[model samples]
Target chain A: MSEPSAPVTLAVDCMGGDHGLSTTLPACARFLQRHPDVKLLLVGQPEAVSAGWSRLKEAAAIPAERVRIVPASEVVSMEDPVEIALRKKKDSSMRVAIAQVKEGQAQAAVSAGNTGALMAIARYVLKTVEGIDRPAIATQMPNAKGAATTVLDLGANVDCTPEHLLQFAIMGSALVSVLKDNPRPSVGLLNIGEEAIKGSETIKKAAELLGAAGERGDINFYGNVEGNDIFKGTTDIVVCDGFVGNVALKASEGLASMIASFLKEEFSRGVFSKVAAVLSYPVLSALKKRLDHRRYNGAALLGLRGLVFKSHGSADALAFGYALESAYDAARHQLLARVEQRIQACVMPSPGAVA
Target chain B: MSEPSAPVTLAVDCMGGDHGLSTTLPACARFLQRHPDVKLLLVGQPEAVSAGWSRLKEAAAIPAERVRIVPASEVVSMEDPVEIALRKKKDSSMRVAIAQVKEGQAQAAVSAGNTGALMAIARYVLKTVEGIDRPAIATQMPNAKGAATTVLDLGANVDCTPEHLLQFAIMGSALVSVLKDNPRPSVGLLNIGEEAIKGSETIKKAAELLGAAGERGDINFYGNVEGNDIFKGTTDIVVCDGFVGNVALKASEGLASMIASFLKEEFSRGVFSKVAAVLSYPVLSALKKRLDHRRYNGAALLGLRGLVFKSHGSADALAFGYALESAYDAARHQLLARVEQRIQACVMPSPGAVA
Candidate 1:
């Protein structure tokens, strides 16, 4: 494959996330500054898009021609059900942005919208890759090894077959190869224990399929790993069903926040403690920087025919920009193509019986 | 129920845990000092038990009659399979300790043994409480609200039916009520989202059962709660299958350890930082004390006919003492009786369909 000389085009869902265009537009402006050879098609209601554009123009040096507004009439609120996102709000900004990717006008799509809606719209508009039954949400997390471990099925499909898990292993391996630049990255099947006989019928059967795929050189399956392995950086990629993945991610987020609050509380307790906090300010900041979630904001919705990244709904401009960068990088590296190739080449066990 | 005039008795598995009698004997010595009216039946190989008892006599004021050595011929190693623990090692220390409770020789049993072996032996010997199909491992986690929330089944049964989740909720609620002395502790069904329509079919069905139970005043079910809610203390009890619970527990542990290491590393970077760490020692110590896992060492293997508390295999003397205290507290509050009553009163939905 030859590198494109022209700028990469990306579709931004302007009316997504908690702050809608307010967060997306400024993020696009900041992203444009870092990625000069890039173009953004901001999709949202016309009036809001125009207003958001004016703010971006005032805030940064984003070129007028490099950014364009694709107006839509409807917006998908975070509370909207999947049915409304799928069939009712056909012209939603989230849907229109995904449509641009489906029509090949944009290489990838980025949204900080409601995750359920974004997944539903992306699946409906772009469809899953051939041979894959369901798509998954793959997010990056900071580990103790000072590298982000990629984990999938963050909350796309609820119940997965062993075949689905095997597919996730393949897709996750491809993702780390592009993101971390490590070909044949180790893939771990997240379970309660590391033993061969541990976990459920589905997990046991998934292990067999993953083991076979590993033997075939499709992925470096590292056998069973526990939840702590995610933060311990025991594997480059961890795969599980959406239910378990989502719980782990949200729980870790909660603990991190609680720890930060505890540190602040400890530092501000008394006069002597305040002085000690001032003396330890730099060290505390270093600790904070090490575990910052914003640096790993984007989650790739894998197995789709096109590239789509889900940003946290409450992400600020900087975090949204990180999501944009992640999506752009995925597109530049032909993440979708790699996923297709790996899935096609991989051997899958019987689905219904294993699960 | 009349208060016991005689001293409370506990069966101690001396040959369990990583440190064997080295950990359990000293812990029992420390426990007997604090709880003067308690007795311990130390079960293990004859020579090891006698040697450990001699050391305990030299260490503290544990009376000879208050601590007796009960010999068992076999030992269950950590790597032993469940079948071996169940059928082969019938006279193992783990089994003998659990048997003491079954034979009314002890009020409760405490072991820091192989989790799989402990659970199998406890189930086979004690059997399940009436109306309960499976046993669950319920452990306490310190929350941001300065209270320990009870979460279960940490890793006993994988691939649980909706009915099993309902049982976990009932059991966890009973646990909190006895431990915290709250008559109607609020219970949260752990899921991906708080909305009624979110989570897997099993979770949804469990919610329905819990909601119905709440309506009947069987349990104060608070509906669906996400992972963050566990640390937020959104409810007194959080219920999930073993797979999700184990992952969440282990992931939290990993993150906590990583954050602590990060803090220490930052404070010890250079000479100036080392001085700063000295000044902030008090604050750091407070943070460490608050998040210490040793304070919450015991996990009650609920649903057994008799009370059995499992300590972490790697616990030190102090941590093991905490597990002993927890077991004593559970026995004193009649935790098993409460569980039996709660399960008998609750209604479980059909098993096959939802999960």
Candidate 2:
């Protein structure tokens, strides 16, 4: 294994996110201020980036030389289709930021812009690794065990074959190893039931592939896991196609919102309940920290040739800063290269030789 | 509509559930003692039924004539496939109970045995309603708004066409009208987003059909709804294919379990939380009641010719009672007849016409 080096540089799509440069610039500034070794390349409309830089300079003692702005006239709307990468929005901030990674001008790229556009631009410019058929967005979710579980293909490929699922499992396993620092991370096939005969033909085939892969010691396969098993941390990596993964991710978010709203309503019902809530404030804050997405902001677009990270479009400065840190981690860990090697090792016919 | 007469008679599979006759018979005996107007036909092994009856008599004061034990020598195991309904388990309690519904001896049937067996038996005997391709299971979930939303195809068919989705929506709409007392239930197609073109081709087609159905007043159709919208009561009836619906249902269950476990762990940390918990016990109890599966049992297998309902395999007496009540509602409301009439009124020359 290679020794960890100095902090990596990240190219930020400064004109992205709900608040655009207002959120992205301050987040970059905060991240840079905290990590002295790291540097930033801000890609956006020149005027907006300059205005954001000036505002940050007034508020904080930011080292001016550590940051540089790359002018990009176009800004992809979050609503734009993936086609925006091909034609009209070629020079968009999102595209240019991704290009910085592809061109090796930056170690990694972070974008809080349109997810589809970012993915398309990343794939179009950086391309996929030799063995990966489709790149997947892998996100970390906080489990009840007080640890994070990796859920992949959050929204990459809509339709997936068994082979695609196998690739995702392999990539996710490598990712969990790097992020969670587990030498042999357990991989689980997400399904409706834990039984072998359950789930669709696609899932069944994926299970068989996982079984074969596990036997080869390429990845640690924990067999089938139901939706409920995700929070239990039954496995370090939960693999599924993009459609189910997307729905599951969104459903979890919706549920968290529902529970939060319910809790607030219950606590505000009467004077007694309000008083109880006051006493429970510390515990509630602890619980909120456990569920907070800011701590797990960076979701790597795994299986791609270059390291690319996606932050939530609605992410604030704190979340965006974490996203930058995630990109740095991926770059330092050589995540892309490690994933490629893992995929190559698994795909070969003679697994014994690789072992 | 006809001033619901006497409570409907339900044939209970005495040799069902994890504990078989031990749990089923006692539950039925207690239920009968509570609802004197209702009758039950208990089907199972004659010896087991007799033993269960003797035990029931000792525990509760129940009239013998109100409950009759029908002799069925066989029982369906939880692991058995749907084929058990066809060849092997001909005289099983699960089959006989369903047969009672078909023979008009029982208004509905309740089985806590294998889900596949119940669905198969119901389809084989009760048949599908005219113009209905396949039956769907519709389960009610507690929304954040304090009202219940009905989600269909919880686990019926894995693959569904746009037409099938439309049919499920229509049946689900009719169900909400009868059960929720909504004169014209608002229906929504469950999708990744609320936009008209947000989902796959199948979803887009289903949306068009729903719009047309809404236009003709065959059903009150709201547009697309995302996963988050399910708990928001964005629409009274949320419809999707069995595959997506099943995933969504299980995801919600997982989310609830996750939150409950998290809260439990947080509250158990110290004495202060224990005091706060006791003070807020009433509010928590109310919340639990709202989210309780017992209050939300009886997922109707809609579009079938008869009133067939599926209860949770692990359901207790309270949940079984709710299933029985739902069956009664479906039977008294003539749910099947209403669905048949609606389909006949809305069937078009081209499936695209409704779309």
Candidate 3:
């Protein structure tokens, strides 16, 4: 991990998510304590953020000068559509937070809001980075190797062409190289089977493009990987269409929660089981902490001209804090510049390097 | 569950899978002991089936008359391509076993062979049932309710049209209604989101067709469901294109295995934890047994003229026994006729009821 620079500023949407100010305010307070040199542009209703900030300033030991409240008249509700958030609610906290990055007031923006609205606003304001057609949400899933596997197009574009898949691979490689400090991370194209003739026509064509790209040394392309490979850590980045990736992500969440419920039921079935649960609590808790998905809460909205990270809509204080920390890391590590350079080098090669 | 009829015969592919006779023979022996009324037509090289049958005969207490060895000149190896297994190896065990169903000698067929080869042979021999354009593989996945949720198109048709998905719903409905004893089981169209306008164009169109089918009372259709819905037991059946279904299934398998490994690591890290592991062993093992994937081994190849069940290639004796019992149950419950009736009633409605 690179050392945090002295002047990395983040614009956070405080009036977003289910808990809104309740979760965002406390997470911001704790985040500031950990990163003393970081500056924050809190975009929300001025009164709410102001009152909460004054209350937390003394307790958190964060100087009043290091924090700023950017006024936003409207709060984007969780159910707000993309059109409403972008065209109608122009001054929404979510949009204003992103505007802070677009206007060069902050290095990055963070939000725990409606995903569609967040993506819409970010794309509208910051625009796409050169050589990218559509932006994708890239996030890390906990893998068997005890490390995270990056997966892209989590829920951004439902219908992706082979070209879009290739773009996702380029952007994902850049994101991983910056975030994980791995320059040549391997990319796996998610498919039903590992063979070339295994998936849909679109996927087969995508395989050809990815294979060619792998030959050119643009990406460390790992050929077709199945669904399980995402959790198996078979590759550093698994690229898929938004529809499939979204299904896989939510399915994992649903299964994890169900297993948790099952574990709870098994441990509390009766007296003997309850005693056993108490004795094994520490070991189990450690395992739970090791595999805590909340620690990987921030999903980068990659392929955009400016940096924006999305937090899960139902994140708690600890989870939101992790989101803030990830945004900080991305900004400190210069994720935006690296994404642009990678896209330029790989997608728009110089005349001499061109085929 | 329906009781097995007096004369239900199943054609077994004795020379498929990794262990060939080693796993298939032992599983068959145990299966016969439990299913007294069922007769087996063991399809393989006559000499091998004869030798294995004679060795397992006295110990398994099976009447020699109940088991018959049918000669197949060649065996369909795991690595064989569809073209090879179909045209070249016409008398292959997998093909010959399926031929038994075609010739009306057996009510059903079971094989643990190369999936592509088996599907090709089954489709070539059995043909698609009246209205079905293509065949689909439907299997049960363990859910939190201590029951299984049947999902269709697991790895059969990677690129399914809207009509193909609708057909899958009909076949899946019939499969569940017959096997699970639910006359009107709800069928869920698997999508990225729960909303009506959530997924790809094919999914959206499939939803409209399914909604119409639900209105006609041909099949009980649940609206759009996410990946988690499968394990949540949100519906009796979940339908998707094979690519998505395959990815979801394999991803779940990977995640489950990873969690198992994680549990072992945590419980054996130290001496105290080791002792704690012993104390929690019974509870954990009970949980494992309750959610064993092996128990859900058999995948029925639906939309065919005859019934054919595919066991997991790596299934052990107990799991293979379950596959046999499932195949027996399908035959006893008349799954093939029920599927035809459902398709005829739904797809080819009467002239008076035409839209």
Candidate 4:
């Protein structure tokens, strides 16, 4: 795919996440200053955007020419179910933000809303891209290599067939190639053990399909990796069913956060600790930044006809800005077209169920 | 469940683990010193034990009266398959160690062998306790509340039915009750989300069976809990299928170890950093100790007729000693009989396979 010279536009769900308008408006302001060629369609209730813009106008001097307010009557709460968000809330800011991509008004969409509801609305509005049976969530986890590992099927398709996993590998490879600028990003099958015969039947069959695909040069498949491989940066991309992927990702996040909190507690104890905290401030800050999940905030919803990224619901303005930058980068690099072309290039045979 | 005055005896697989006699012998010598009421049956090649005994004899004065040499002609390699270790290596130290427990020669067994081989051999020799369909691996992970959370079915039954999950809850509760001395330890179903409607069909059905068991006083089911809850100390026991449980636990360990190493790297960069490191040495060591997996080395293989605990294959003498203590505690507290009693009281209505 050829890189386009035209400016990229992104639809921002201003009424999403926990802080909603407060965090999103400031994030939009900061994002606009850094990305001169990027334009934003701020989707939210008219009054909320009007009032919120005034609050952020003094602190952030956002260019007026590149910004436009796209009014939506309803907001998708984080607690809303898929059915309610898809059918009931027709004018939700989250759904309308995605609609901008479907209608070609914007090159991509970014939202920090309910993940289940976001997937449901995005799938309904922008159907699966050709050759994909299901869409998957591909997110980055910071690794020891000072980069990130792209892992897919995070809480999207819980019960994935072997073909679905293969589809994920194809979609994930495309996503990583675009994001990392690697022509042949490696893909790994996430399993219990490195051995081929360790996991369940679904994983075994998935391994065979992946191996065959690798031989045909469909994707650069690195045979098998265990959970530690994700953080060890053993491969650029790790693929698994949504159930295990989601749990493993969350558990890692939990442990990392716990360790960070524990370090904070240890530094705040007594006089010696206070001296240690001051003397070790530089090292501690570096360690925190290296381990922070906030810096890696965006998760792409791949296999859809259009591009949409989900930011963490609890992200602050700085973290939300990272999500916007990720979306802008994806759109500028033609991630959607690259993904479609990559899937089209691969032709894997569908395996009949083995008794 | 009565507290008997009989001396607790443990069969040690001296030839197991990466360090073999070097770690196990010192660990056993230290264990015998601390636990004056415990007896050890060290199983290994006859000559190896005889020669190794002299090496440890200088560094440690292990009481001759309290230790017995049990001869095993073969050693189970860490890479041995279940079939090879179970059938081919019939006289393996791992198998003979468990056999001592079966023959009532030792009250319990502790081995740092190939996990799959250990599970298979132990299951074959001891069999599952009455009323249990499968034996599970229950291990503790350190949490925020300065206690460990016990997680079960780790890499044992990859594909578990709803009934099997209920059985795990019952077995886990009994194990925790015996270990923690809490009559009703809270049990949580490890799922993608805490919502009741969130997981796969199998998990949803398992939730129902666990709820029923909770109502009948068979377990202390705390509804559905997500992955983060395990480390948050939200529940005493977290239960999931072996595939998910194994991956989650390993992922946590990988992240924790990565953080520790990163802290070390940051502290060794320059002279100023070295000064900071000296100033923060106590705080750093405290953080390291809090996150260390070595303190929680033993993993109990539950639901077996006799007691068995698996130590980490890479454990050093200090870590292996913790495992021996865990086994000694489990056997002394009569964990096996309590687990059997709990399963018998469960009486969950096993439904036919749901289409």
Candidate 5:
């Protein structure tokens, strides 16, 4: 894409995730086996990685040179993301993995560790891109309309200013360019109502800024969208502060769980219902595949100086494998640098310049 | 409850909801038929109410004296919650019903109108309670644990201060006491993490205030609770700003839809899965019943001078019926007066101190 740069190498935090190396190592090995040209720098405790390596080798032959283990003394727990990232776990596997990206040892980094810790490490070491105040994590959400919509600030900056939200919109638009493949992505500010005048004075002001920005052709702002609009694929990018984004993300997950429970009851009502279920099997399978989180493995932390991706904490081998590929794609696309340059090019005189 | 209060009559907005007056009028008629001592004031266009009333008489022999129709000139459309609530037909059923409560002709009011409009009208007419800065809508969410948990600031106040959140906790506890029969309800602040230091400065300050209040036995405060903690039924009342609460509720609804789609796919996978679906019918149905919004209708507009319930805009007959029943329950229980008394008794330093 950018004059065919050398093959990308990613630092994988092997000790991360719920199951740790038991799932991470095999996934990395499998991913390498599938993409021989790609390289991996596995950062974790040596003994644990070695044990997992042995099991992976015994199960299937792996190219020795394609994967290398970089020993690190600590492993950040699921607890206190900020404290561990800042103080206690300076030499942790996650930190070490991030350091590799900062030092140019690897093109990108991928981790299933504590999200806050990952974010903190990325912000502190790699630093925010020029013209960006805070970085945000943007993930692709499967919509009912058979399209994947990007929702950002999934849990980054809890309290955000209008300027911060505008930055997120720009970064998110850049992401959609690389990921969703839309040249001009349609962005919507997540709000209680679609009306421009709806929500708080802060939101109302943000809406005006977004509208002005859209008119200037800086970012494709589609005005305000509501909670239900997320799954309907109403817009390509949905922006919100981390607090709202986090709650929206979790709430969607909760709603999915509730719906699953409801359907199980509906189809089990009678023998006739059971027959209808069989008749609808193919359609249902397609729908499940569409909704599966495993298919969309990683979320990119945008507005940063480097590429960093966060996989689901409960991610298994297949999901983790996808995360690696995602990181490789982000690195090759030079997403971070592209977004930074675009934002810098559009510097405005007022606080609402980008708005 | 407060010496029976002279048979409090409720004005039901019969033209509201998706099912319209066809469902609303019969439900009100049935409710009045069961409670012979209670009077029903149907507020809508007189002809429509009479038509629906005739149907109720044919279906269940509803007594004529128990119900009366107060003609309204118009019906509020579902399109605009704010605009329609303010500028649209002055004689709309929702407005007239609210007017009845404001005029003291009815002790309380129930509406299945646009949520924003109901809130707007309620605030404009009933006004805020004596020491309450804002009126918040509180809903009873039925958790998987087979208990209803009260989640407040559903959609009334989007932006809230620490003092507002603390007041919500106080008001929510009182509502829970009336609805769930929990004398001293456990109140929790919904946050990203459990630790007191986890959220924004606003949340932290609110947590300190809540801690102080809990120490004095004013309300049972359960420290900080995360989004997942909601369905666990860990606390009797969950307090948050309106934005978070609205997103959480919608997200829960979305997640439920997603999960339902997943299970339908799983059940129709094959013959074996189909058989499992049949076997699990009763258990699944029981679970669905627990999640059904119909049974848990009527979100109370707490911290208000009068008892007002906001039913879901998409609610069907059963949910509207529940709204009527809930409004009746709140009036008969003198819920608002109880809340006022509780706040004055607990939070106020002295009898003459401001609430």
Candidate 6:
């Protein structure tokens, strides 16, 4: 960790997510109280940011020196086209927050806005790490073992070659190693089956790359694993193309929501059931706490030179705070440097790079 | 449905699945007792079939005229290569069972063996429907509303084109119509997002084909749906390439299993929790029964000329019986004829035939 004279700062896009200011400002206030050593550069419309600050001033002991209002004239709506957001919305809160990272005013940026727009803007300003073909969205999924498994390329680069998957595996491993404090975190190539012969040509070729990398001590490759293995926590890191990963993640979220609703409906059925529900409320709540998606809200946009994290657009105050915490952790642990070193060591140079 | 002069017969691959004869024989015996009008032709080695019949005679009341024994010297192990099973294992139980449909000896074939081998053998013996590009695996997923949503191309054809997906939607609609007596079953094109611009070119093209088909009254096409929509019962049928469908299905299975185990673990944590668990036992058991994967056992291999159902490999007697029951229902409803009619009506002539 680097000991700097200046406080580590994080630029947060306050005009993002579902309930923009209501969620982001309160979450930032809570975060500031929790982390005395860190400061926040709240990037959004000046009036809204000032109004939020005044509302939270006394209750949150608004640290005047620790918080700064970075004015942004425009906002990026969730439905904005990536290209339009990149070119037109130059002073949007998402862009301004990312610019803080680019201009060295803040160590990292966090946004709970349009994923496509955020990625496009971040890539345009910060660019990907040197040897990395594309940036991947890495997120934590709570597994059956009560630990989180890191999965990457959730939906950033949809069409990936075997080389890109291999890069994902290495980057995911590095992120996991730093977060979990484990040097040799195992990485699993997400395939249709555990058998070597299964899956598309791309997945098979990716398997070969990961296997060879494992042998060379670049990554602790755990061979091929299926979709079920992701929840089973079969490995520390699960790697796949953005398309498959996105489908799997969304499907999982869908199923989890359905199951939770079903449980709620069943428990409220009758007098006897209601009584049982009341009696078992503690256990149910405990289980709910364990499986809460909010606990795993922050997803790091890996492979970029400047650190950035994406929060769920629908996240509330607590969930948004978790995203800020995640970005703060990444910036504090030198995640970008670790990812760069690992990518440089493992990933083969692109054909363009060779040229 | 055509009223057959004789009893509807189903060919059973006795040497398939994990337990081979042990699981299939008992399941078949149970099925026979439950549905007296249905007969089974047990295909396997003569000695094993005879031994199983003798063992199940008194208990299951083995009807002598209804059951037949077909001797086959070879067995297709789950790990065997599809090509080898197709060529060398011509006399294998799986092949013989499918051949019964080819030779018009049975209305349908049921196998709990290797999927690749079954698809290969069935396609080779029965051939694809004239306009169909490839066969797909259609399975039922129980939803919140206590109805099954039919998802197709589960793992049958890994790589699929727009035309192939269009064919799957037609066939799936026909299957649901016959099974649930719902003529206009809504089919959703699975994608990363519900937006038109999201997903790959292949999915985009498939969506266009489905939309056109829906306009022509060939099938009911719902717009794009995310993963969660599968369990939400958003549509009657969810169509995608084999790879995405397979991943979604397996991941959901893994999650369901994990959630069950977690519930059990939490409820048994302490004395107070254990008492609460006992009180909530009925509700828990009801939930378990509702979400039971065993209840949704059979997966029909669709788009072939003749009817075939693939049972889960590790299914026990009860689960295997469910598979047999599914095949019997399909035969009774004439699912194959319905599928063929739908495909012929919607699908364009194959290039081979057109030329």
DockQ of 3: 0.58
Q: Flag the better candidate by lDDT, 2 or 3.
A: 3
lDDT, candidate 3, B79-106, per-residue tens: 7777888889999999999999999999
Off by over 4 Å in 3: A1-4, A194-197, A348-355, B1-4, B194-197, B347-355
lDDT of 1 by residue, B169-238 (tens): 8888889888888889999988996222378888888888888889988889998889998888889999
Question: Model 4, range B269-310, lDDT digits (tens) per residue?
Answer: 999999999999988998888888888898999888999999
Candidate 5 C-alpha error for residue A25, in Å: 2.2
DockQ of each: 0.60, 0.46, 0.58, 0.58, 0.27, 0.59
Work out the iRMS of candidate 4.
2.2
Task: Give the range of the ten consecutive residues with the poorest summed lDDT in model 3 chain A.
Answer: A346-355
Residues B1-355 of candidate 5 have per-residue lDDT tens digits of: 2346558699889887767787787678667767767888899989878876887776777677767899997987666657666676788898899889888888888988877777777787788776677788899876545577789888788778888888899899988887667798899898874121267888888889899999998899999877765776778889998888887777666555554555666677788777766665665566557767788889899877788888887887777878888888888888888989877766632222353
Better of 4 and 6 by DockQ: 6
Off by over 4 Å in 5: A1-6, A17-19, A80-84, A87-89, A194-197, A257-295, A314-318, A341-355, B1-8, B17-23, B33-37, B74-92, B194-197, B258-288, B348-355
lDDT of residue B157 for candidate 6? 74
Over 4 Å off, model 1: A1-6, A194-197, A350-355, B1-6, B194-197, B348-355
Angstrom error of the Cα, residue A234, model 4: value is 0.9
For candidate 2, write residues A1-355 as lDDT tens digits: 5648676778999888778888998888788778778788999999878986988866778777778899999998777776755578888999899899888888899998878778878888998877677789899988867788899888777667787888888899888787667889998888764121267777778889889989989889998887767777788999987777777777677767776788789889899989878877876777677777788898899988899999999999999988998998888888878887887778533222234
Name model 6 segments beyond 4 Å from true.
A1-6, A194-197, A347-349, B1-6, B194-197, B347-355
Q: Rank the models by lDDT, top first.
A: 4, 3, 1, 6, 2, 5
Clashing residue pairs found in predicted model 4: none
Q: Report the candidate with higher lDDT, 1 versus 5.
A: 1
Residue B8, model 4: Cα distance from true site in angstroms: 1.1
Q: Report model 5's TM-score to 2 decimal places.
A: 0.87
Error of 3 at A354 (Å): 12
Q: How would the docking of model 6 be graded?
A: medium
Clashing pairs in 3: none
DockQ of the two-chain complex in candidate 4: 0.58
| Each model's chain A TM-score | 0.95, 0.94, 0.96, 0.95, 0.91, 0.96
TM-score of chain B of each: 0.95, 0.93, 0.95, 0.95, 0.91, 0.96
